[model samples]
Target: MKLLRWTPLALALLAGAGTASAQDKPDPNLARNLAATCAGCHGTGGRTVPGSAVEPLAGADSAVLMQKLRDFRSGARPATIMHQISKGYTEAQLELIAAYFAARK
Candidate 1:
């Protein structure tokens, strides 16, 4: 009789445990998610709209992208807005964004 009464409590605890574990797992699309912020200017997958004048990041060299981002963050490269935007991300996040765009065709 006691075991039967406790069964519901045990099941509830188990269900909550599953939810906690799921939340603990890191998102698999982190890089893509991080890069999505750039879509406003860089275009989807880093391909700028035709004749848009904004430089396309798609298929660019990762090293070059890294340098450009670093410059933007450091104010070494003058920009109307990029310098301000670049300052928001850490180096690791910038690297991920660069890698994601470089991989896109």
Candidate 2:
């Protein structure tokens, strides 16, 4: 009876799990290039730099990351470092960067 009960529960869980991955599609090329600038703080190969003051961005969400970049570009989020860097980027470049990081696994 225990084995029979467990089978139904496991099948339900497996069905639910499949839907979660359906929405997680990411672009490959963008993720690769965006990695360059990200490496400055987050470390190369998506690893966080040891004892670095900056927070790691290895697996951050794409939409959230894009909005942050947009905010930095617009002077809405006011970080001196980000403000300076964001100013140098074009809108296209920003999109590419956002797409790249968002694609990270």
Global lDDT of each candidate? 0.92, 0.71
lDDT of 2 by residue, 23-51 (tens): 47654555466558767766764567678
Candidate 1 at 105: error in angstroms? 0.6
Candidate 2 segments exceeding 4 Å error: 1-31
Candidate 1 lDDT at 85 equals 88
Query: lDDT per residue, candidate 1, 1-105, as tens digits?
Result: 999999999999999999999999977798899989989998998999999989999999999999999999998998989999899998988988899998999
Top TM-score model: 1
Give the Å shift of residue 1 in candidate 1.
24
Candidate 1: lDDT of 87? Answer: 91
Please report how far candidate 2 places residue 13 from its true position, in Å: 64
lDDT of 2: 0.71
| Model 2 TM-score (2 dp) | 0.56
- As for candidate 2, its clashing pairs are 30-100, 31-100
Clashing pairs in 1: none
